[model samples]
Target: MDAFEEYLMTNLPEAPSFHPVFNEALQAMLLAGGKRFRPRLLLAVVDAYTPLLRESAYPVAMALEMFHTYSLVHDDLPVMDNADLRRGEPTLHKRYDEVTAVLVGDALNTHAFYLIANAPLHNDAKVALVQELAYSGGIGGMVLGQAIDCWFEGEKLTPEQVDFLHEYKTGRLIAASLKMGAIIAGLDEKMQRELFDFGLDVGLLFQIQDDIIDATESSETAGKTTGNDEDKNSYINHFGLEGSCERADALAARIGERLASFDAPLRRSLEALLKPYLARHKTK
Candidate 1:
């Protein structure tokens, strides 16, 4: 197991039968691996500044992952996407009961805050990080985005509306991943804002690529249900498949251009982190 996994194993809740099932279910969902993209982004930003901060950044990295996992758990609940599969395994609600899944998501959400608050950073830094996360994951961010998505289901949204939907829904947290690292590294405000913009572009590119994949790939290949977005509002619904792919490529190029503006070494490091996703776009 990696450091993050090891930390989770040691720190996540365990039990003596009072609620073993809940703990077990939460652990299972968490340990069921996904991309780990957000934490990797956080660590990369930290590494660009100083390798020494990597160890200290682990808690913050894990907090981001935990919070992201919480979103996935709740997103897959019966009342939401009602997904049966995630990361190539049964979703928590399917593997356990709906109530267990709900509580597991709740536990993870609160636990993420605990990790951030207890991290070994300065209290001021901690406060900033907490505030960033709260805004990204709370009412004005992911929650609002989700609400808009659900409320507008089956209705055609304008390009501007779709952009707004994704900017908050997925972009905020991804942007926060980089911003948190900048906070830890004490980067200047201007540089932090740039990193956040970089993350936002990447987030938009990711969502568009996901829409293409949902339209083109199968569930078994995607590790989750595909074609489910056919009935929902998505980039593919507004733009055709070819149009979405083109948009994704343009977004990737934009991200590359933005990354190129950084100092050479940091630019290269960030590019290396982005290579996998960029390569995917090239294959199209």
Candidate 2:
């Protein structure tokens, strides 16, 4: 198996075969393909800070993915983005019906906490992970970001306002994903911060790349409708293509500098992750 695949297989959450609904929900959720960047980053974190923390960080990482998936599911709900597709498949609500989709998302989000809180890892470590996930996923991060995005959509925004919207809306979880990894390994605050900073830049670049892709790629290639942000403010809309490209490059380069401080393979992988954004710019 690939390193990522192995990492995923190693730390699966324990489920009673009897909980058919719960098991089916989880399976349905996981089978949906995502970038898996967050969980992998968490694993990378475990590798860097303390691989010895567990024989498998999979369950913990998967928990984070569940939370993320929950966000996506809800983000596409009728009252939200109102999208009809995801991962090149019918969205949960579209496929399973709205009630099923909403409940499934709720289940995943809560179950994510359960998995990490009850992880076979050390109690202190598991407790810390739970807090991190909650803080990042709750008011501090993804949910708040979505709230802001919804509130601000179809409205005018200044540069700072746009930046704040983007940072909270998308950048927070990206930063948290990295910090969660570092925290899982029990890294000190200073080191954890450095990783968080690195995550912020990379996460920003990821969002910018999405903008560029939306501007340049077709809906078929991107799996979601392109130009959806045409009505919404984005780095590309405000900064324009060339300016966004310049910003993405500068951000990625700075992240590269920070990644250099770490000898860990995960850090190296993150640094390499920037390469795709850079390459995407050229294609655009």
User: lDDT tens string, model 2, 165-205?
Assistant: 77777777888888877877877899778777777777788
Best candidate, TM-score-wise?
A: 1
> In model 2, where is the ten-residue run with the lowest total lDDT?
275-284
Model 1 per-residue lDDT tens digits across residues 100-214: 9998889888888888898888899899999988998887578888899888988888899999999888888898888888899888889889888888998888889888888
Whole-model lDDT per candidate: 0.84, 0.74
What are the TM-scores, per candidate, against the unseen true structure? 0.95, 0.88
Error of 1 at 128 (Å): 0.5
Clashing pairs in 1: none
Task: Judge candidate 1 against the unseen true structure and give its global Cα lDDT, from 0 to 1.
Answer: 0.84
Query: Which consecutive 10 residues in model 1 have the weakest lDDT in total?
Result: 275-284
- Which stretches of model 2 miss by more than 4 angstroms? 1-26, 264-266, 272-274, 278-280
Q: In model 2, what is the error at residue 26, expressed in angstroms?
A: 4.5
